[model samples]
Target: MGNTINRRSFLGLAGVGGAIFASGLSGWATAETKPGVANDDFFFVQLSDSHWGFEGPPNPDARGTLQKAVAAVNGLESQPDFIMFTGDLTHTTDDPAERRKRLSEFKKIVADLKVKNTHFMPGEHDAALDYGKAFQEFFGETHYTFDHKGVHFIVLDNVSDPAGSIGDAQLAWLAADLAEQPADARIVVFTHRPLFDLYPQWDWATRDGAKAVALLMPHAHVTVFYGHIHQENHHMTGHIAHHSAKSLIFPLPAPGSQPKRTPLPWDSAYPYRGLGFREVEAQRQETQYKIVELPVRKV
Candidate 1:
């Protein structure tokens, strides 16, 4: 199917952020048809930091925000090829039973999505307390890889380790995985923490993410999608691109924008502000991606 997004569908989705087109693996570029290998173009939905059991002043409708997001995705004019929740499916809980309960609740809520080919990863809130023991019981592996169309996707587990490191074992595995791919292969990576040190004082940077970047640097076409900071951020490591998704529960302050990293206060006048998900359109043939951020609710 053609991957062009129609105006009606775009308007109906209620985008809150401007669309970003990443091309040439270095900076933005206009969308143009390039003759090359025949590859299918596809798009996927990215939802993150739901914090399912979270309750407090940061958000008054935390209970309903996630459900609203699911409904929004379901109501899309065209269903995505797949949906990926980058992490923090549930809020942190000290009690193991409560953690399991939150995870179970989150699973039930998202099951209502019209598209069933959904993927998931864990955030520190859901895994750090138990080293992903509870999360693994719900979701499968903490890290794995798969291919769609002509693109190879790598989901790394950085939060499973309390110190926020991808660990030596996963790094070696990543090297092996990259070695199997051609230098010009289209690659996408998903992780909870930023692969580069965005802000170490606030725990936003992964401990050993530099090693993972080194493994990916040699590849010509690589893009990363990650979430944990509860905001949308785009960065580049040499020719590779990294994009962060917004949170579903609440928005956090910008990286090192304040004395401490905390959730921006709930805005009564504008409900669900700074909270939403994103849809990523990937043109495998051209090695280009377009990102559109959608609101949790129509204003």
Candidate 2:
């Protein structure tokens, strides 16, 4: 079941888009916030598909729009301890200087971010152009794991293959990495593309996503956070929940539902107002997390 909560009122392009609050069963927006990081408390930010290179249309000014999102996130009342950007950090093309310029501009824009920790993973646009060689140089390891608040966070690199699948080596590492996790411990996975067969025609789903999902089935509490869809949506298989983030760029049409899978025409009357991030909160031990989508807008 799903519910539409508060339309948090995000900035829309020239008053086109309005805030939308739709959620799944995990809907619980808390008024009381836990102070600091506790034994059973912690939250992180998820921002994806910034698309720094693209220009015009949906967003008349992509760079300006992104800057606005930066401001909105930096000014959060309860600032997240860290943030993760899922993918599509840059536009297409494999120019080394262009790549450096896009990344440098992105970093420069974020230099003013107040958050203490910020993590980044490459997407097809960033990785595919150079086979992720430059991506690794700029952003470091594509696949790695971390333990936070007793929760396991596995960031995978699924953008390498044109088919959008995790190669055998990464898959093997993931299985071994997750083999010993206890049922009670929370396991959260992050990637640029989705892990499900969302829409193969448009390259929305991960080809080898089932393998990853199978490995994750043993864990009681598992949430997979993904980007690249450029919009908010969710799907579930067994106990695991899969979520995709909204892009700082333009919104794409829903998967499979689209006739041609092209960038649907943005409602010109309501321009693009964006800069959104996802918030995942873990309450008491073993309690499912409270995930919230926070969209950034000009004040």
Candidate 3:
């Protein structure tokens, strides 16, 4: 039997103020299976681009948004197995002291989460200025790999170089990591920027992302989740799937939709319009994952 998810109850708890989208994953199985062993299903939450210290016309409630998201996640009827913040936990600041301060405050806010099994990465805003030194001090390694029930999770650092490149060294590390896994392993990658050249004119592409994709091409079941574009996007790199998450601070216009990649204007009537997080429920036996887009605040 497959694991059952109470979608309606989850959306109700998450305050489903926006549209909900779903996708499927095939050939996903547990890491180790023994006779009579059952494959259990689990879920995790992905929250990105909170921009904790941002203050601008794009979002009047900048200071309060991240808090609202934390409260919403805490309110979930079924707490996620883990939580992941793809990147941009704080806004960009050139001042070293202020940057660390913002990171500290962001950390403090999220500590309220009901679920403590959380993972983090960095966005250019939090890392580029100092090549991720401060972020590393706060969040540990920028790139790493961890195994869940049956899935291999890889967190790649593309923003730390300032040049927006993963660099050859990390690519080699990624290659070595993949080589140790079976060719048909169920792999998921988390990164701050899109691994493909979504739109290079606006600095949305990773410098050597193609190389990273090439190294991942041999894996049969691979998915990439990322944030930075500030909107939901889905794309395919051959057999691999890449999904981008929305921002908690504000949303940007669709790729190449405008001359500049600026945040969409704040709509006073519809506060938190384009800002939200997601819940990903992995049904291992069924070989699919359901993603629910949730609002920052309940209506």
- TM-scores of all candidate predictions against the true structure: 0.88, 0.83, 0.91
Model 3 residue 161 distance off true place after TM-score fit, in angstroms: 0.7
RMSD versus native structure for model 3:
3.8
Worst 10 residues of 1 by lDDT: 24-33
Cα RMSD to the true fold for all candidates? 4.3, 5.9, 3.8
What lDDT does each candidate get?
Answer: 0.80, 0.69, 0.82
Task: Please give the TM-score that candidate 3 achieves against the real structure.
Answer: 0.91
lDDT value for model 2: 0.69
User: Pick by lDDT: which candidate is best?
Assistant: 3
Model 3, 73-93: lDDT tens per residue?
A: 776666788999999999999
Show where candidate 3 strays beyond 4 Å: 1-24, 30-39, 288-299
Q: Which sequence of candidate numbers ranks them by TM-score, best first?
A: 3, 1, 2
lDDT of 1 by residue, 1-299 (tens): 13334422442333232233433332212233233543455677788899999997888777887887776677766788898999999999899999999999999999999899999999999999899999999988989998875667899999989999999999999999999987777788999999999999999999999999999999877889899998888888998888888888878899989999888997676677787777677653344454444443345
**Clashes per model (N, Cα, C within 3 A):** 0, 2, 0
Which residue pairs clash within candidate 3?
A: none
Comparing 1 with 3 on TM-score, the higher-scoring candidate is 3
Which candidate number has the best TM-score?
Answer: 3
Predicted candidate 2 versus true structure: per-residue lDDT over 24-102, tens digit per residue: 2131222222335433455666778888889877666676756765665665556666778888888876688888788
